[model samples]
Target chain A: MESERSVVIAPEALDDLIGALRRRGFRVLGPTVRDGAIVYDELDSASELPIGVTDRQEPGSYRLEERDDEARFGYAVGPHSWKRFLFPPRITLWRAKAENGGRKIEEEPPNETQLAFIGVRSCELSAIAIQDRVFIGGKFVDRDYAARRDGAFLLAVNCGEPGANCFCASMDAGPRVRDPYDLALTEMLDGEHRFLVEVGSERGADVLAELPSVPASQSDVASALAVTNDAAARMTKAMPQVDLHALLAGSLEHPRWDDVASRCLSCTNCTLVCPTCFCSSVEDTSDLAGVETARERVWDSCFSLDYSYIHGGSIRASSRSRYRQWLTHKLGTWVDQFGTAGCVGCGRCITWCPVGIDITEEVAALSKQEEKSHAATA
Target chain B: MATATPSELHPVGAFVPLPFRVAERRQDTGDTWTLTLEPEESGFAVEPGQFAMVHVFGVGEVPISVSGPPERPGDPIVLTVRAVGAVSGAICASELGALLGLRGPCGNSWPIAEATAGDVVVVAGGIGLAPLRPVVLHTLAQRDSYGAVSVLYGARTPADLLYTDQLEEWRSTIAVDVTVDAAEPPWKGKVGVVPKLVATAEFRPEAVTAFVCGPEVMMHFTVQALRERGVPDERIMLSLERDMRCGIGLCGHCQLGPTLVCRDGPVYSQADVGALLGVREL
Candidate 1:
């Protein structure tokens, strides 16, 4: 069924697609080479993409190297996810001023940027969907996130290069593009540099109608499927097949938490790089005369000492407790809160952790301990 | 690229606070003050155990429980705040006629409606009495609707006790037993933890609905006392406190296990949060 809607476009026509989006008033953002990493940034043309670049990622490591062939979207995800754009780092919530011996409050205007994201990975799409539930699916919605997300265009790219740390297959989140995208592209690098683009929405069909392209051949569709299949086959890491929520719930008192705490740093690197972490804190700032004031929301992490602060002191003060909170919340209680796991298995948390603490490794240890306890009880 | 109409945007007034003028202010203690605020435009209706996000313009916002009876349109909203942090301190120092921002009546309310036929036991410690004040007032207004009603209250010292005059007034209608952790030589009353007083209170333990609120440690001990006295866990209601920023549950600061305390509860039965309370630093 997908083969009928799929079309083929040459490598040069990628620039035309960007032009069409920009002409339609979208601020196109895509992957680009910056500061020795492939980070998402504003792109005026396809020339700005990380051409001939591939990234090698492992726990506590990321390195960009040249690929043997020119595959534009060859690399797995980098440090930046689309979260920083949809849910910005800092935003003014409202402003207040002293007016005529009384206080007058003013709300910040709704965001109006129509974003067009390029090179979005499948795991990232799941992350976006998870955040959508967090922000908009609840009883109270975040109007700002809704504004940016509703008007944005998502261009998904099927994965052909799974990072060493990526375990999206185990989480059932990626390696193959899914719904909630405008257009899904599978970059084919065999013999000819072309793309098999499948239209996921009407807007995608409209854009494809404008671009110079041909209906995808059977061979082209097969090549695209083979690309994702090979990528999935190449994945080396996977989350152990167990009920993660029950595992963490039963293993809360396991001694592995203390062992992991000895090596875990509460540096908040994993949360910042994660695509679905949405915790935040707000700040109220005032002018010198104390007449004008504004409140701004900023990203916050559970690993921070002040994140769980009450009147007397921090709740999760110990490194063991903080790490336990992050892991348990992401893997265990998040399912209970949002009806899905908070983690996408994108491996950003693993690749960016300075201490090289791996989530899958920790879970495996906890699972082993749980089995031992059950064995003794039996 | 198309512009979204206003209708397409979800009405998100959750973060915006409504203006309320401080109509009356009374210092309950040296550190605690109760402010009765009249809404400038619309009314702020709240249930018994619900709370409000009170804002002092330039300082910050903090969640304070409504301490007065349920109000109608144009009625005043009441909040009792203690100067424990910078935001509460600013709210405590606000003068009369000062305009403050309020964003609540957020979170689930106590199951007062479900306790009609059952005896009600209200246990409060220190400033925790503020949130439970409405429950007492509501039960007293319809005095004949239930069996024996009791109020067990405790504070750090006599000087830290809130609503002293009302406590004396309520004694004539219901069993009001007050205790302090410590007192001077002149003070003659029960001088022990509030949980100890819970055992001596007169009520049918099997048929009583217990509402307990205080510091976490105090509430834990009170729950133990109630359980020991044969009160069921589901009937033991508790109001919990956590660091809250956005009272609407978006900020993710008030999570206790799977529940966002700001959204799912400021109030929960002992059966709901018992395991959560047992876990240290959860």
Candidate 2:
């Protein structure tokens, strides 16, 4: 099955693959150059892919740089993730209308658009799986998320060129596409621009049978493995290997929180760009004459002052507390809630933050604080 | 892909509200109101500490405890709300026969069934009495099952007290002690905080299962009083309040430490959440 599953295709064959998906009633979505940054958008052809593109990312900064070769999927993740497609930023939950004597309530039907997500990174796959735990894996399923997830097709791309902030190697989430993807692609640029395609599922095999492809030679598979291995080696940032949950649980009063709060804007950029941050709030609005009403679920951040609002006031009124809540929940308490860490080491939180508060750096600081406190007690 | 069946598409998975009509409405105080709601189709039975997400049509929803007696499932669902926010204000203003939306009977309930043959101490502060009202009533209904039962209630003032008539009537069967933070003329009961009343409550600390609900500070002091009285941490229970959008626990607003207060608890033993309560602004 290993030899039968591996195949190689020319760069142009990507067009036929997209065409095949579209013919099968899937709206193909992939990375494209949008507003000077690579973003996921509807794709009609493979030419729309971000070819000859790479990204340079640092804390609080992101920029698109021209690559020396035309290799698609040559960049780390951007601000936009597949979360926007799965758990939309805003969706109508239900609608209500004033009827005779009583109100008539109607729930919004589950979204049924079949989506073929192309170029899904390994970390992004982990993010999706984490959200799957959050929405559908719990006692109550988010029907919308379940429907969208059940019908979607995943086309994972193994990372070949990791960015400055890439740390999926440390989080054990990626650089290699080992998650449950329909088809995994590794772009090779040794003399010829081609993709080594590995069929990950029966559906992936069916799709490959329709496309013009050949069995992958020993060299082809080796080169593909080397691409991801090189990316792992190129990673510069990493989360320190420690019991992060205990570190955070003991550092609730650590002054490092105040330090981050001073630099933190509480702008919610990290949460908004986060692929697995699932916090949301519901809003109810009515039309004029108070006849028709709709309830909308919108993406909400814990950093927002009102996110923790109760009857009297917001429980976490201070910026320090709110920042602490976001970080502690993402890296610490998230494991207890969903059996996994919320952060997938995607680095979007660090790259997109306005103040450039690097989560990795903060955790390192917290670790150092923990060591210092232990030494003092000793 | 297969489409969802009718049962799979049920509103329970989508957080959709079921229609309920306000069968009875009574203003408990100047700002608080107790509403009895009847389901238009099927009714939901709730345990003593369980709560419901009461919705006011165009207005949003808020988590309110089931204030009605748990023994009376045939009776309409009772919710006592204070006009503190927009949603609660709309619920408080709901008139009799007004249609509203409801979801849940969510979160864990008080362990009254487990406290049989032991004393029970029910403590409430201000509007906090609404959630614990069921515990006191449940104890009264099964009077012989428990050794001793007491209800210690406190409010900002006599004007802010809820269920005044019910408090006097409950005195006939159980020990009901009411206190005020401060009082004006004609006020003639205890004049200290509610935790002080815990000292004179008629319950043996060794055999007592204490249920407490109130403002965070008040609950903190009350739990301290219970601890000083030798009540085991596991036996002291409290209901928590937090911002919640989905009462089913997906919204993540009601998270306290590792627990989603909406799912893991609105009611928790002191031994479970004591350290978290001590964390400032947690």
Candidate 3:
């Protein structure tokens, strides 16, 4: 492991580096500026990248801004995530062609995957962790996710420019990549935009050997640290730290909920943007001739009314209850079961919330008011 | 929908539609239909409150609780189904002894061993009683294991009451309290809902653990009443009813937030449902 070290890639020859990756049978995917926002998509060359692009994000709002510097690792999360590439929203679980009255079952052929994700933030890695628990951790693993996860590799980029909506620093997920990556890149794009690449696994080191990268000097390491430390300290968005699980579980009857519920659109944008939210609906498709039938699982949300339907009625029939369920489970009770906070505190819920309902703010308010009431009683 | 070729049994998570013949159909009320299925293979083993995916090959599959007993685990698994959607409607419309597909006796059931006969309260509202029927049967069979048994049931109206025959038998043999939302002209039973009756009914709170299954509104009210009566959230248990399409905990249709209703529960206490209780649409 000590022999596995960092390599410094020159900024001028970034395209040559991308070519090296392509030659090694890696379909390099990364953040590219598209439709006024930085989107994660397939990048064939360095020219397709978000070279001089940045982004602006707030609670329920997002905007893109171009940077004067020709740096690539200058943004946080955008509309596109690695989930689309790995766990697609819709994939053929199985397909059948109906023949005669009885439907014949056939094997669904598996597809090959050779993706190499670039610039995955730490929080996104954590998100991948959550997804792994769902798809791979269970007894019946999703074979498709398994093949994709195993075949594809990662190129985790350290966050040099944090978006306004970014809360990876607060969530303890990033500003850097820590786990589940092949190569973790510290984009020391300050003064001179060069990459400090750390090979996490054997595959990463093998990829590094192909690129024209130099052994990093002490100053290069220090320069990379300085860039990362600055961004970690400069994270703009935060939710206050309260015992999230306890606070949420205790405040079942808290009246502040009504105030928040009034503004929540129940549009499910928070969940859609959320990398950890994995709820899906099952659909059975029959052929036009009405012989063969196929069943599929598609992404579903708690916000939908039909999700809770039983005999004649739906259990959770109101928006308020749905919001309460999503937030409480994400922050509170999830700890008791999954042994971790369901939320990585990405601030996507805060920013993508059409109502600007910040979870951290709510927990803080609850704590403050409870303290006040207790003092009054005392 | 990319569907697999319909195989006899699927791979570990493969969707296998187990075609069974509905040998018997019993209508306890105008709304609820109970079917006894005879699958080609035996060993349709399940516990009380666990559910099975009843499929109409052309229509779709819906999750209905296994209200049958463990005594006859291999014979035929009984499903007390209520008409709701296209698939359920198809099953209801189909003749007795009609061919149907079954997938599972999925999810955990009520831990009957946890409840002693000291004093057990079985509360059901409308068709919610169907899921609890197996527990009732199991408890009745093992009469000496329990102390005193009482079943409290509430329905929309006299005409809406389900399992009328079974309720009559339980009334004669066990301590039973049946109520309706509104009493009819000839109705001599309790007029109020189940919660109002349960709050006043005396039972041993120390030794008693309640099994309450009902509409979401009724269960909430019933649970609140139980908690107010000094029963711990853990003691006062309720089975949730959700839109279960796969019934195998895969489809998010049965999820109440992160808790898979088909897996973690259809049975939850106030402690479990509290997070989910706030979200009405969940």
Candidate 4:
């Protein structure tokens, strides 16, 4: 690998980077204000980015408002992540039509289109890596996810302001980017509005050659580092430092599960917002004439009672079992299965939860029970 | 390791089903039938205890175990399906010469090699016997290699029993015993749960490696009976049933605790999964 290089670019020149990527046949996708919050979509220029906008996020709450300072990428993550683009919500697996003497099965090819994602946060990058373990890291890779992932280019943005519900620092994922990216930009607005760009790959260097930028000075790098450090200190929530995998696994019958289950609506909002949740179910539908059939895979959540259904009845009958399964699987057994924790600590699940149920609080409750049990033994 | 073998495991991109012709169909019970399928093209290989995702044209796909012996040069793959649900009912209703789609031989199987030098015991209840048919045939074919072979089968009633001729034929070489839960007159056999037959079966607890397939409740009781008789947990094997969506680890439908019953197992030793089975609503 080549040594890293840095550059200084004014806020207006950011459009030139977008133009360079578009010239190279990349459909650049960036965050834009939509439906009361910033969501990712196709972007033609930097004007489409959520500039001068910040989000107010808390447990079971998310709202966007205007900001006095015009800082690009000022907000934390929204409800959606990049998973929607890689692993689509619904995919057509195959189609079968009644042929001459027998029905012929036809396979549907995967979407191998090229894409470039802009303004990816550190937590989102960790989420993508976790999903890669589930879909692409195994012996049998998911062809659709692998193709899309292999063809895409990532543009990371280091966070300067951690949102109210953000806890990526505790998860060891956030406030700063660590994953491999084509290019990384840290927006520094301390008296001077300029971005400290770090070229992470050869592709990033090639694109940097096309843009008009000056070599960043040592002070510029210091300013960028300070911005991320302040953001980490400002994080409102902190995940408890405990052996989460062991604690949750042993707390299967803990009473705190019942308390949270009563408040949970099982609407699946938390799973839908979670960047790493990848459970899906297949649906086979026939045409009105009943000559052709289509098999499709669609996203499904564990909160649904039918997700674990068998022939006679559903395996997880109560909301209590379902919630317990989700939390334990995401935080506990996931480490054993995938060699990593499922949650990226993006706090999207907390902000998007309708009933304000916080995973951090639930984990803390379980940890407290364990401490009491240990004390009794002592 | 009930997970698929390297050769039989297909990447997700190969989700397309292949058309196979139903060469023969035999009805064993009112709601159950055994269908023998010949793939339109050759080169299809399926291992014993493995299953296939069988698709009926307009209905849907359901995971059915390959009931036949390991594929021979020109033999067909056999599947014993019972009409327990809508998808299975449609599959059982298909006529001969009809074409159905198949996509598997996925998941792991019973360890036949381990039983070669030791006592081989097989327990099948109701339709669960379909998956274990291969193990029985394989052990009997190499009867001289194993110490002793015993097959204990049970069904709801005498009429509900499957493979009558095969059972009688197997008795000539292997120890085959049949029982019914509620039998009607003239029929004189044991009338109790399937695990009770384990007491009368000829095998030493130290040398026996049992293979079981049945309802979850029956497997639980049978495993208990085996453990009480001093059979180690690792030597006792059983196949589990769940709502398997994707016959791979991608879909989370068939997960039981830390194990993905599709990829990690449908077959597991009692020592490996005894604690997992104890967890409620897992």
Candidate 5:
């Protein structure tokens, strides 16, 4: 086991870390400015990061703004998550071709590359852990996901500023780095513009031994803790927790569902942006020659009416039922199925929703309705 | 972490469909056909009430119940498909010697051990009878273990009724009563809904275990009538139908509230899923 070690690295030495990972043959991915928002993509040097930039995010709104100081990691989650790279939106499971009056089936060739993710927030790390439960920890392990996960490396960042929609503190998933990462870094720009690096795993210590860094002083560690605690105190949003599982489960018939459904467009933006949503659909298509076929699995959202379609008609014909299913399944029944809440409180669902349907607000409204019903019953 | 169980019985991922040679295909009604498929490899057996995701070559795939017995492990897997949709229609049009893709023997099975000690009543409606045909066959094969077995079925018309020959052959050992919603001039038989036949059947409510399958509306009424007869909720089982794409729990298409019908059940006791059945658009 590798003992915990902390060090102080100047802002300029960040390039050495990127170079070290590249030397290790890892395709390093980090946040960069693209399409007027920060998106994760290939980063060859630390200069590619969104330097001196912060993002303003609200329900159904996101915009990049220039910060007074150079904060390399100041944004919350973007529209895309790490799920796109891990459990890709589309993957071919197998292929088949016509043979002598029969068919010959072949397993899909395994495809995975060595990956190292940089600028990963604590909430996103929790989201990754949630997906780990679904794809790898379930009764039947997803072979494709297991292969990619085995060859991946993670470098997590502590959140020094929480977004307006973020509630990771309430979910107990963020504002502080708790889970194991290859390397953890906390940016301290208040007095000295330097990063406090904490080595977590053996791989993290190996990389730290290569970089030139001095031992972190007591003040550096204390300042890093202050940064995370300040972010936790700054968050304005929170999830209501008055028997939330039972509240959502029993409130299936609550009239507030109709109100939310009326505002919802059912465009499937939430599920697409959600980090922990794991529902998918399979499609089998053949070539124009009519001899070859390929079965592919793609990400699917419960908001679609066709998601529940059978021989007769759609099971959830109304948008009200669909929205209710999405909410209760995420916050309530997910605990029953996976032994954890489906949400990691990254706030991507709220920030990317088209009609500004905030989950925190909706859960609070439902909790209030349950309280009123309880009072009346009493 | 440890890898999953051995690969022979359980594959790493449960999505791949293997090829099964269609040894024989017989049309029972105008739109319904039964295909007995011999797998290229042996050791794949299917129990009653389980289903298979049958791929129709270039078209697509649909879930059809295995309406065959599991008495022998190497016996051909049998499926009865009704050509109501595009994929099933393509399946019904396939040749006898052609090869189709098959995935499972997936989902839960009927509780034969419990039903054997009590009186069994099998109720079905229209094409919904396809999944229950195996239950009827299993009960008769083990007739000595059960008491006063009965089968009550209903169809839209005489032309829509499936497995008439087998239904007639089973009459010597068990009480088989069938009805139709409408009939032609020369037809002389019972003409009403399926639940009405349940009222006229001879079985002790306290000692009976009923299995019902059919269209959603028909199943709703059949469960209501069975409850009125004083059959306890747990004693009545129903095989449900949904848009099961993956035929596994991974796909969220078949979820009904907390239950994934593909995994938790296509066969659920009325007591387990009764409250959810009548909930509108749930």
Candidate 6:
């Protein structure tokens, strides 16, 4: 509102920019090279970003590829994002020490750091929005997820280049953010040295005020648009969810599941890599002395036998049923249950799957079956 | 439409490791322990068939049925927990004064309101009786409020009947007909399964509501027994248990068809889950 929140920064402005954020005392969490993938971690400088580097991805495969040109964020999706900052994989629900016959209760603190999640992708924001529906908009709410989500600052990045596994364009979720972000940074790699930014929040405007910036001419904005368009058009994967809820709803006896089950490793890597998957199990443990104790909510997966157990037996006993449950919930019942598509089409599950079980390919197969069955009846 | 009203859903939760003064611990088997917890101050009188998510502090919580009657007001309720997971394993090792976290008395309970006038047959198997024990106790307390009542229970063996002393108490009053898959040398009661007993029992199905809880196999046969005896699906109730990680209903782990066992039920009419039974491995 004060003039503009937009602060156009060149590639060289990254280091000083990180220093400014650090001086302001924000624990800046952003992307960095880790184990052959871009992962979010504590960063102090632009050097942490994989400059002149990009990633190659596919179902069941992820590899690093050398970038022909240098750009901090010249690529699309990464394995890490704001999710880890908000919904931790494991968290302590209760802590207690010995007191007489019962354990005395202990407490956990709320977010201790002023978190600034940098380099958030548009699709990731969509995932976050979906998670909001799950954690904050239900009959019962999750206090911890709310605390982490509410006070944190966001810095979303529109896609400048599509990864081989990316299908956000097909899902109509990304490349350019339709909405939801404090500030959206559009990387203009075509420029000799720079990135163009658009601020979407008042907080973003104030943050931009302290950074060295100048008004971008119309050409800069136009070039930024071109880069995003190229990324959207170059996307390697495509998924159609048109009437997916109905398709899945009607697919109770779909035989394509048997095909998928035969190859699925039941490794749960897909759920682990997925940003929105949030099934968790509660754990309670005690010290041998019986003096202290704790309860924790750790991530759980449907692939595990223990995930579904009653006094008698597991309901979804077969791997086929487990797979069917997960697929149906993700694409079908989720809409009836949560009123939103459970997937963001970011394609992390594709690249991380060890057996290369592609959700897009699976949906396409199901859609194909629907057409075939319709033809058979007609 | 978010199933989980996240921020407010888990309204009061924080696993606090506290020494749960183990008021008592009864070893039900090599892998099962019936524990009675006394809330540090004055334990809440949880309803019949209600459960407490028992936490071993650090391990996590599991829904354990309260086996004791709530009429005593603040008296601790009994929990017959089999050592199937981490929490159960720790509770099996816990002694009096061991600390633990308590989450709730959640999920829909037995319809104590509707089971009036008509006779009620409470059938349970193995540790499944723990969840049904409260209903049994409440029925006995207000004996005049309901009609003729009876309890039929079975277990893997003679020793598996949880709360044996309580079984004797109910038996001494009327009949706590206990059965087993296979009777032992010392076995004295009926040497058959629960559903078999139901088939031969003298209860009138037309004037009764049979609440059955057991291994799906046992319940499967029991449902058949009631149906053959002319009991309508609506008159027969069952406790449908599944993997209920987040009892608040956000996690899709326990969804069965259009219902979530965590929220819509741990209790359901036969008609509610019959479609699920039709699907293989549902």
Task: State the weakest 10-residue window (summed lDDT) of model 2 chain A.
Answer: A1-10
| Clashing residue pairs for model 4 | B2-B108
* TM-score for candidate 3: 0.85
Q: How accurate is candidate 5 locally (lDDT)?
A: 0.85
Question: What DockQ do you compute for every candidate structure?
Answer: 0.63, 0.62, 0.29, 0.41, 0.48, 0.32
Predicted chain A of candidate 3: TM-score: 0.92
Looking at model 6 chain A, report the run of 10 residues with the lowest lDDT sum: A1-10
Question: Could you give candidate 6's per-residue lDDT for residues A1-378 as a string of tens digits?
Answer: 112345577777667666766776678888888888888999988899888888888778778888888878876677665777788888886567655544557556555556777788878888888889888777767767776776466778889878888888887788788656767778886746677778887767667666777877677777878888988889878886568888877777889988998998888887887888877776667788756766677878878777887655777777788888777777777776677877888898888888888898988889899999999999
Ranking by lDDT, best first? 1, 2, 4, 5, 6, 3
lDDT by residue for model 5 (B1-282), tens: 123322322344566777777889999899999888887765367778888889876678888888884456567887888988999998888788878888877789888778877899999998878888888888888999998899999999999889999889999999999999999877798899998888878788999999999988888899889989999999899999988888777777888877888877899999998888877777
- Per residue, candidate 6 scores C-alpha lDDT tens digits across B126-235 of 87788888788778877887777888899888767677888888875545778888876877778788888777665677888888888777888988988998888887
Segments of candidate 4 deviating more than 4 angstroms = A1-4, B1-12, B69-75
Q: What are the per-residue Cα lDDT tens digits for candidate 3 across A1-378?
A: 122388788765567766767887778888888788777887888888888877777777888777888777777788766877667777655544444423344445444546788778888888888777766676556665665666567778777877776777777787767767888778876567788888887877777787787888888888878777888889877656667777777766677767777888888888777877777776778878666667665777777777677666767677777777777777775665455776765667776787777777777777787778779999
Best by TM-score: 1
Q: Model 3 chain B: which ten-residue window has the lowest total lDDT?
A: B1-10
RMSD of each: 1.2, 1.5, 4.6, 3.8, 2.6, 4.6
**Model 5 misses residue B67 by how many Å?**
0.7
- Candidate number achieving the greatest lDDT relative to the actual structure: 1
Best by DockQ: 1
**For candidate 5, lDDT tens digit of each residue in A202-231?**
888888788888888888888988989999
Q: What is the DockQ (computed on Cα atoms) for candidate 1?
A: 0.63
**What is the docking quality class of candidate 6?**
acceptable
* TM-scores for every predicted model: 0.98, 0.98, 0.85, 0.96, 0.96, 0.85
